[model samples]
Target chain A: MATPTPTRQRRRGHDPESVLATAVGVFNERGYDGTSMEDLARALGVTKSAIYYHVPGKEQLLSRALDRALDGLFEMVADERASSGAAIERLEWVVRQSVRLLIDRLPYVTLLLRVRGNSGTELAALERRREFDRFISRLVTEAATEGSIRADVDPGLVTRLLFGSVNSITEWYQPARGASADDLADALLKMTFGGLRVDPAA
Target chain B: MATPTPTRQRRRGHDPESVLATAVGVFNERGYDGTSMEDLARALGVTKSAIYYHVPGKEQLLSRALDRALDGLFEMVADERASSGAAIERLEWVVRQSVRLLIDRLPYVTLLLRVRGNSGTELAALERRREFDRFISRLVTEAATEGSIRADVDPGLVTRLLFGSVNSITEWYQPARGASADDLADALLKMTFGGLRVDPAA
Candidate 1:
């Protein structure tokens, strides 16, 4: 109590991570542009000063939320399952993991997906998003070259279509109301790989 | 000049539709909150008053752009091809037409896809989007019931997945840089119906 507990050591009720989680939901609902420190404080049931103790301002909160989503995504691509399997197998693994990740981090991912590059943080996030897309695009290109999927669709187009479908999950998926993550992942994989892999029997 | 032609009939270069088209691009680029009437006028090489002459304000520009996208989508469902054929066939037709429409009306559709519902116009557009999604969800349900597509996936989820992939076309499909609309539609249909239709062979 003498030195004033560091932000990390703050009580369980108001940790930075928990605050960011709550912040993500508010950001997604009201939009980064429409939300303010006062709004965030009101949602968190804390004063603006309390929020300030952990982060600088709304932009930093936005940056942290984007980082949370991008980190999960980039981590999936780096996972051995995503990196080591046959190109198609690896792609399937990434796709499955991506759905699971989207469900697990729904709020953060939702905020990241909706960013319009209005701020420095958002522009950086967009660049990282493009980097992530390029990484997957390479996987699709490799899968096509290996003849693991249809050769006719341009790999870039395939990447867009596949993730477009994946990212759209944010719009409708509610973990509390809908299909289980496993069920969602299983169905998505079937539809994705069914359309992707050249043959169903294979 | 004698009749003081209405803005719609003022000139080919300054028609409402063309001005709206330009506005869509600006909205997509600047995050609707970040854009202003002055920004729009600058983009169109017109005075702010000129833009106001065609559209009442920034909100109207956003509303009109959303209407353009929503109208095309509603028209598809009302079409004989979307409303009448076997569930799968109708869905395939809609999918094909959606791709073609997204390409043809790329800017309007892009702007519509990015709205975050922060204002009256956005909230209204969001409701219409939900209506459009509900329409598609019904199609997927009918298709599943007819055994024309996989029944394991929830039709609601299927609608999201199908459109997620389809709507994603806006992220990357540049008519100037990529595949022809026919080519994009062909690949998407093959992937979409290939995964959706119950029988891969049929």
Candidate 2:
């Protein structure tokens, strides 16, 4: 039999990356439950099957997006832990890297932030996120012991405060025209570690 | 004709208050969009029309819930601003009141926290929320000028971090066995003012 012509590229019009980006936007707009495959299909002007071809399912799409951000965060932990520096310095380094990562992966990180984990995959992601938190908590504990940080501040509270400050960047930041991620990181760190008290009376 | 007997009084069923409590639960569990009128009705074992009797519509229900929390927050600002205290003291007072308000209105506050303002009502609520934020930011600016806080931190950033820390308490705090809101507030003040770093070296 004559060789059949090779099949046309299936997703030439539909790039997976752009599709995922659209999914994040929809998820961000409507939230997880509020959004559906149909909504995504409508936005893309394509059929559900096309989305299925790009992503196995909605959960997988969520997983993929979260995994990308989680990977960036986890890598920061590993890299910061390896770099040569005192505990506080290392903590500051981690803060800078984290802000950069959060800003760079804004959509993914925004989605990651909203994950409630009613699903098995999401529960796993939450576990991983918690593990990442614990890693930072341990660093704060060690830094406290080294007399690098104030001993009075509860380490757990400190951990939450730091992450909270970092995470708020996701709320107001727009990469289109504003401070770079590193600039934000520096600003956050300077304000946080340094304190807002400009004229401390001895 | 004989007066018609009230069916609700005759039947063993959910009351309006109980239904509202259940609606709040559903709202928190599934979020605003994730929830439906049917979901609330089903969760309460009532018909949708029954809900309408108590709460004209979903928008009214959300408004009632969100308004409760917003009222508590705005009350704090007004109460603190009017209280007998210095600038720093007023700020501290507001912080304490806010934490208490947060715990008292946990579900409503959670819903408030999750709002992305896709709806007109939510957008209005968000605008009011920003007005609250602006009020708090003013306190930060004045407090910094008064030497109540360190000036190294930007007032806007400090405001975000302080509230971020306070709001984060709702995420992990359980009223049964967790630290009281007051304790959380006290811890937040110290952390924000002095930070995690040990300052005795000075």
What DockQ does each prediction reach against the true complex?
0.36, 0.46
Where model 2 places Cα greater than 4 Å from the true spot, the runs are: A1-10, A80-84, B1-17, B80-85, B200-202
Off by over 4 Å in 1: A1-12, A33-35, A45-51, A57-59, A116-120, A196-202, B1-13, B33-52, B116-124, B195-202
Give the local distance difference test score of model 2: 0.77
TM-scores of all models?
Answer: 0.82, 0.88
TM-score of 2: 0.88
Candidate lDDT (C-alpha), each:
0.80, 0.77
Tell me the native contact fraction for each prediction: 0.47, 0.46
Clashing pairs in 1: A165-B165
